[model samples]
Target: MSFDEMDVESIWMDGEFVEWDEAQIHVLTHGLHYGTGVFEGIRCYDTAKGPAIFRWDEHIERLYDSAKPYDMEIPYDKEELTEATLELIRREGLESCYIRPIAYYGYGMLGLNPSDCDEEVAIAAWPWGAYLGEDALENGVDVAISSWRKYASSQIPTNAKTTGTYINSVLASLEAESNGYVEAIVLNKEGNVAEGPGENLFIVRDGELYTPGLAESILDGITRQSVIEIAEDLGYTVHDDATISRGELYTADELFFTGTAAEVTPIRSVDDNQIGSGTKGPITDQIQTKFFEIVEEQPEEYEHWFMPVEQ
Candidate 1:
């Protein structure tokens, strides 16, 4: 849904809470011009206990780490950002929502270098449903191999969630959607499967799980890591470092994409070629089921993954 359609009211900017409409930045902002910013997408689930953020600590750590490559330093510490996010949700009375924490260079000189610009940070939360669509989680989404290839880490820090690098994803997504596919599977420079436009890809074969490794020019997605652990704990052999080829996607028994937004969505087809039964496979269902269960129920076994909003 669009922000205008939501009932959100406040946004945490820098160290203060500002009215949602008041949260604005100049067009001359360095990050806006040069994409010299880092951001994180996180989820807060409405669990049995109440609203709780999933894996918030890890997300915060990654947000900071993403800034390292650009020499940008976030002004707020982890605790401060955490508190700001929690308070923002509480103020908005959001039981379940998607959180976006962004740090970027503020308005200053227009040169390619941002040495003189100040760093600006903001956190916003709003209700969001399944990214691909609610039906996508059940029936699976159809995808196509993008004509566009994912850029190599050598050219850019593929692991970092840089704002500018997403033009590659924009192109791939546009290509797939224009061709009538729900999503796109991007390939690396080597013609190996990298990941989805905004998610990590996992292929299941012979009841085992496989995903592209960090070296495959994919982001180290938090949900990707969580799913890896969840699949392993369920007695499935996972090849985390496996390099997947385009041909392998069509031949896989099942396929899925994982990320903060996509969560665990099954990919039913690639290039219109049906995978397995052309629907959510058994293994994919099991992992997706467990993932929702953990987020909604907040079971003690995985309690460490949740950070209660009330606390």
Candidate 2:
């Protein structure tokens, strides 16, 4: 059967497995209205051993953590959602797919307050190859420094993965595309580089690695943390501090972005200035290669991050 013909089941409204086509939510749902929800992006990789969920525990933990700032309680516990996500992927027989878990305030009487609405959880899986398409990493992406600044912690918790906060990212991304750029780097209110619209930013300079510090008003991404750990383990010196000025990014030896969806993608240019001869640098390529190997190779040390699913 073709991929489209394959039966896919999803966990709907309160954890009911229904045909994917039948999964529905009201238009007036609180989350839809005021964006009162939080979500996660997880990847399941098809390996020689079987299909394994990558960083399964980390993703689930972040899902709950993201909800805390919004005061949105996930109706299910960690293990509950964990097992359900695995089951959803298996039901679809997806060897390699992306899993999305969302917890949001369901339909309720119209008002801005979300505490009155019941929380709804849903899990959906689909075949996802690359988030930004194939050529994004191969040739490196052209990035623009967005006019939209990252939301300050005073406005909303900068750490949580809230749907509401993504409006800024959405706007930045759309603007970048319309301006002939593949992605955007959003700065903080103080005009310091924070991160990519949905990814963490890293720069290499003088044989040292640098990324915006935690207080830089960027989401502390799981993939960003993993990349840093992997780099340190490989004997690289990392400097986490403020990254300001376009001059810094333009003159860096290499520039790259890290996140669940973006993975480790190299940036070829920032606006019109060429970064390191306008090509994917050596360090960026090394980290990307190592990341792929670990995600697919099942190294003993990283085995705990994978949840095996086999028929």
C-alpha RMSD of each candidate structure in angstroms: 0.6, 2.2
Worst 10 residues of 1 by lDDT: 1-10
TM-score of 2: 0.95
lDDT of 1 by residue, 1-311 (tens): 78789899999998999999999999999999889999999999999989999999999999999999999989999999999999999999999999999999999898888989999999999999999999999999999999999999999999899999999999999999999999999999999999999999999999999999999999999999999999999999999999998999999999999999999999999998999999999999999999999999999999999999998
lDDT of each: 0.95, 0.85
Candidate 1 clash pair list:
none
- Model 1 residue 307 CA deviation (Å) reads 0.5
C-alpha TM-score for every candidate: 0.99, 0.95
Clash tally for model 2: 0
Clashing pairs in 2: none
